[model samples]
Target: MFDQKDLDSIRESRQEWESETLEPFLEKGERKERFATVSNHEVDRLYTPEDVSNIDYDEDLGYPGEPPYTRGPYPTMYRGRTWTMRQFAGFGTAEETNERFHYLINEGQTGLSTAFDMPSLMGIDSDHPMSEGEVGKEGVAVDTLRDMEILFDGIDISKISTSFTINPSAAVIYAMYIALADQQGVPREEVRGTLQNDMLKEFIAQKEWVIPPEPSLDVVTDTVEFAVEETPKFHPISVSGYHIREAGSTAVQEAAFTLADGFAYVEDCLDRGLEIDEFAPLLSFFFNSHNSIFEEVAKFRAARRIYSRVMEEWYGAEADESKRLKFHTQTAGQSLTAQQPLNNIVRVTIQALAAVMGGSQSLHTNSYDEALALPSEEAVRVALRTQQIIADESGAADIVDPMGGSFTIEKLTNEMEAEIMAYIEEIKEMGDGSVRDGVLNGIPQGYFHREIQDASYEYQKRVDSGEEVVVGVNEYTIDEEADPDILKIDPETRNRQLERLKAVKDERDDAAVEEMLEELSEAIDNGENVMPYIIDAVKAYVTMGEIMEVFEDHHGAYQETASLA
Candidate 1:
């Protein structure tokens, strides 16, 4: 956006300054080493307009809420309203987690993000033999619709937005949400929520798949189609990069791979004859905000720009909402450390700010002690307060794209865009120009796995060599023992959950549950939308394990053959 004469003048001045000021100072050897970023990119002493001379204001960065949304997605951005503070909270039994949810809502959290326990996430009931010690160890143990009902006991479905962080049993979890909504007398169309129904990422990173990859995709596509027609206000799938990043992908891979998965979903939906505009608007993203402020901001900006172009140019999307990229961001859980765990509060603050500056629609700041255990009540409150201070006191929400037009940020953003586009091109080529084929086949072929492995290997090498410094990890050493009060899973949590499950089973109509399950099975076999059927089954008090067994019987189970070497 700089004039040619002005750019040239600035470039000459920069060169002169570098030779006279920078070079002379370096010759003194006052500084022993060159500066490098967390990504191991060498940092320039200074950035000038010359670095962004090729950028076109109109095309690369028009106004916010416009094409190629490099600036920000919304025109007024946070000035319109601050981003949602959606602190992810779930632990122990449904009653226990429900209390935590109530505490967060009372603590000014704007949205509900549920974290399911391992058993529930794996499509296993609390009483399953395989689920013995893991009932509510990681998150809330949701065995049946009765647990779901207790999970939202006093919560108003129509007034709040709920986001579930479950993958393998997404259909079952979605069924519970819908059934709960129905019982609450809330219209299907009025329900607002997001399901992390992204199965591709599960195969590529998280390893949380229930059915095989191909059939898993069918389930995801079915949810998208059903949401388009039934629950228009709800986001059927939150195509996520958080787990990918947690699994050790670089920032570029996080964006490229996650968006590639989103494209795969689009491909499936389009193949099912659903219009791009119809379901694309409901497509939302989940990204990770690591400690690198500029990199995180650049990554977020690049994601919006690339998604808009892909939607409009590649998918024939017309509506603005269909093309606009909206996302939720969680502070990097991998960045937290156990040693001097209080240091994590500062790390979380920085990461949370990066997410805010990057224009996330919602944010979840990880609890400082999360590296130790499920967040204690005090730790989670501090995490929520981190976002509150950023929004209310920091004055960061007064403008749109606060980092836009800065010389370094613009350069990094341009670099991020180009790199992510290249990755997308590579993924498409791997799939024979179809993102669907590339991701589906690439999973078994270890394409995504190998890339992330290589990136992580290089990153760890940097850390081990002291080229990259983590504050409390390699740089700082505290000899004193940390005595932080940490949250521990209660020993009785599993028993409580199992007892509740037994009660629900005993009280429910067994005949009606069987009938509804049969209907669901028929719909799954007949290629009919199973959402309505699933809703009916959950309402009949079908346990998650039972429903998942039906899916396994029909769709078969998957064992990923990809090697992680």
Candidate 2:
């Protein structure tokens, strides 16, 4: 924090430099242009001391690892420990993905993030009629506990943490993970990872959902409660803004909406009589690191500041750990272009740098050729090396929050925070009580739809007007044929996976499977915590579809009614 006299002197010097040196150097007939960020917020050409004049250094931008951690959440940050290098991986059967996991680990990846295929994502077994050609297409397919066992066959669960990018059926997946850890002779407390158990974002952005909103929230809260008692190190809900951003929301909307969803989860847990500090610390966040360099950096900084203030002032979270907003960032997959495939390497490197500068706890760099298809072994290595270069070669991480207290960065951080709060108010005004309660009543969905449509329209306008240029997309028109060496899953893998699933089904006791499912259904009907029963069902080799069938019979599927008329 500079003193008043020092601030005045710096401002006077900057004014003289701009008037005498900068202005005269510009072309005489050049007209000033208003630059806007990816979020469509207007950005000024320059920021002076006047922009951050009201900022109290002690209260607003404290030292790293201190309260009001606008600087960073850690004391030494990357200097002490670099951000975790987690490559999001999955393809074909569990065995194939397991080999990929081992390969990445051998390549020096620090964490594991699993991606389930459509069938597994929808809580359907590989043998389901709905899962014909889609098995092992997009991501890996796990039908039962046996698949999970094979997925991490040789990997030590206790030595490495694994993140599951699943929702709607996150509880079931988590139950399988817990059961797997138990089978590995590791205590539940020793197992660590995150479950992207955010159902609200699923309805708002990604439409991969199963149960109705109320029941879904109940199941998610059940996981939260169970995590507090069983696996304290595991994050129950990774409230994700990544999908929302991919769905075309602006950067500010990404921050505010994601945090709003996080608050909704916290409120749900509190309503269930859980203590705020008990479950809030286990709550984590997932956000996007787009191509905007400075804007993305400011977005991450503002997210931490806003979450810290919200937890301390609004929720009265006592523990410092509870107030911390730890987040994982993935480079914008939607931003990748297939035109000039090699250019994507530069794109991902810059995005990965932004995430590191923004103080991410974990990061996943999109492979260069991802826009074409799943990455080849060579492409994934480049992605991993991108992070390694930043961590080792770049001096950006030498100091914690290197951009902290910068005139332009502070100004952008303040502006982004205000924009996010305005969006929150807009959602509240458009709905009944709070936006979360309104979401339960089906009001927030309409608001989200309209907002996304408008944002997309504005983005297209910029592209059409040639105001915003994507290098390979709208600018460089390349007519190259195609790259054929990309990774492709074999058709035989699907056949083998299906055959294995069927063999397991036949070997299991049919009577015990039915009995376990009946007990699971009874637990759901009796309003009992279904985690234990679901774990039991999975252990009995009950297929995912059969388990979901029991729940669907009791709770029914989700039906979204259009209330916009």
Candidate 3:
């Protein structure tokens, strides 16, 4: 940003100021140690033009909506349209979650994010033996197309964008969604939504796999191929780093791991004969907005730059849309505390603010009482209002990339980009020139597991040692009583959901369901795109477990062991 002579002059002036102006304060006791960011990168006390003198602005910090977009994804950004505010809601039953969805939309939410219960995510029906006591406890329970119909009953599929937080059974759920659209008579191209079909992240972070790595990835590829040919506007998979970050990864690891996972999906799609530009634009990412304000903002910027270059150069993607990285951000759930629960509201607000400043396309602000249970309706409203206040009242969204020119942000963004590139290069080398191979190799060997475990351990140690003071966790203690209302799922929600499942089975034609399953098996055996067959089974009201049983039998289950050790 500055000429050589001016940079040299500034550096000289900085040294003089540090000696003459800062030395006296240090001598009088200003503390004698260096500082670092949450990611543990060294931080200078002050940043100036001299700090970013080596940066080439056009090559690194281009205008928004341009090549190697480091500012924002679009030209107008929030000026044209603010980020979509979505609240991740689902619990108890389909009826209950549908009510929450309607409530959120009526309360000014721009999008819907669904959280499926464990059984639904695991491909088990509500009435399954293993699903006892767990049905509809954490999120909405869906077993068949009947549940899918009720889950999105009256909502117009053409207008509202919905995001599903289902992972392992993403394909089955996606088929259910397509069947729902078909039953509603909506055009397939009009069905806009995102599916978290990222099984690689499941292997590396969540460990919720029913099928082993290779086959699980093929299922993901199947969905990508189906979407490319059928649903033009839909995002078949959201490569999520939110769970990875929630699993305790540092900022750099979160970005690197998430991007690597996206790359793996890209490679798999290419193997299926899909061009990079054809399906790449539909790819999306999900990230966690943690407490570190500047670090998170810089990480977002660096992620865009890294992805843009990777697609354009490494993957041979020619289209600008293919090169751009689009993502949804959710405020960090791990930052919330059970003690002095209201403090969580502030934490969420800060994290949400970081996401907005970081130029998120969509955001989900966690409710204050999420640490206690599912968020109360009132608490969810407050969380929605937080995004509204930031958009309309806080003036933060009035300008695009508001911190683009800051010296500290520029330096941090550059440093982060370099570090992420190094990580990607390592992955590429490991995979023999394929990023997918590298992450796949790492998962069985426990590289991601060990790295995240150590990072979490170190962070907990800091909090325990009082070096890192969590507001309500370590430093703040209160004995006074505060009984805030908590959202509780009815214990009978399980029985009601199970009853509904039975009613659907009793009402549907058993012969049709059997026929659909047989056809689906034939399609799978013939290596045909199973989406059409899965849709047929879903429309016939075949249970999720029944469909996944076919896959489980074919691919078998996985047991994680230390291959990388």
Candidate 4:
């Protein structure tokens, strides 16, 4: 970036100024003992050309839409079109959540992101004993195709892109959506959305699973293979770091572990005889944006660069889309506080800005009151307005890679790239050159859990010791007790869901449901792609529980082997 003579001159000048000016000023005023990010990367007082002297402009930070995509994925980025404003909303019965969907869309949201209830996510019906008191508590419940039909009753499927945040039972959800598309007269190729189907992360952090790792992963690969031929526009899998980060990982670990999980899926797909370029382009990612603006930005940038290199070099991907890492960003839920909950709006604003500057394809700004309960209508509208303000009022979106040339940002991106690549290398070595086997081997061994646990413990220790000041949690003490209006699930929500499920069961043809379920069971047993069979069962109104029961009988329930204390 600079000539040797010029660098030498600047180095001498910096030394003289630091000693004569900075040293005296620091001695009088004093400075903090240390400055570091959540990842424990030291922050220098100043950055110069020397900090990024080793970087190659074209090779490392190419123009937008080019290889290694460090600056941004597209040449115009937000200049061409703003990031999609997709809010995650779901609670109570399908009718209720559908109303919220209409509210968000009418409030200027461009996309839909669904959150399933515990019962739906666990692949059980609302009336199941295991689902007692849990139905419609956290997210929306959909037990059969009837619920899905009501969930999108009036919405035109071809017009809006939707994302489903569910795993383990993702294949079931996919079938329901495709069946809905069929009912709506929309061609499968035209329907678009994303499925958060990354199951490896389920074992590592989220702890939501029915079967063990291997078969859970096989079901995921089936969707990927099925999507390539069927739902061409839909993303079959979103390799996620959001849950991993929310479970307490440093930004580096979040990026590394998420990408490794993605690679494992890629390997599994390849082993299934799918071409690299065929399925890779449709694969997407999800990440969390915390309060560390610069660190989070650097993490996103480094991830893009690393993914591009590996896709092309390791997998021999021919298409640029296969190499580019396109991801959706959600503001950190862990950063939200129950006390002084309003402060989360400010936190979300900052995190959302970082995501835009870091080049996210889509963004979800969490409501300030999410720490207490599901967002009220008023709260959710305010959250949507935050994104509108950033896109229209703020000048941050006018340029591509607004922070591309910053010395500190570039330096941090380089360091982040190095650390993330090293972790992937270790995972690969663990499996003796197979990332799929490595992740599979690591899960039962608690390797990933320990890494995340250690980081989480260290961060908690810092907060407890006052080394890290969480504004509402550790510092700025306040004493007040007032109940703010929050969205509450009615005690009758579970009963309503069960009644609806029972009505659907009574109305649908029992013989058709049983025959479809038997066919689905055979598909699973024969090691065949179960997607078509699942779609058939969903269309037959086979309850999610009935379909999942076949799986439990065959695969058995998953029991955690990794011990953590």
Two-way TM-score contest, 2 vs 3, winner: 3
TM-score (all chains, Cα) for each model: 0.98, 0.96, 0.98, 0.99
Q: Lowest lDDT 10-mer window, candidate 2?
A: 438-447
Q: How far is candidate 4 from the true structure (C-alpha RMSD, Å)?
A: 1.1
Model 2 lDDT tens row, 444-481: 35666666657877887888787878887789777788
lDDT of 4 by residue, 109-149 (tens): 89999999998898888989999989998999989999999
Instruction: Quote the positional error of residue 20 for candidate 4 in Å.
Output: 1.7
- Model 1, 325-417: lDDT tens per residue? 999999999989888888999999999898989999999999999888888889988998889899989988887899999999999888889
Which residue pairs show collisions in model 2? none
Q: Between which residue pairs do clashes occur in model 3?
A: 445-564
lDDT of 3 by residue, 485-510 (tens): 98888999999988988998999899
lDDT of each: 0.89, 0.87, 0.88, 0.93
What is the lDDT, from 0 to 100, of the residue 448 in candidate 4? 92
Instruction: Please provide the root mean square deviation of candidate 3 (C-alpha atoms, Å).
Output: 1.5
Report the error of model 4 at residue 416, Å.
0.6
Q: TM-score of the candidate numbered 4? A: 0.99
Q: Is candidate 1 or candidate 2 better by lDDT?
A: 1
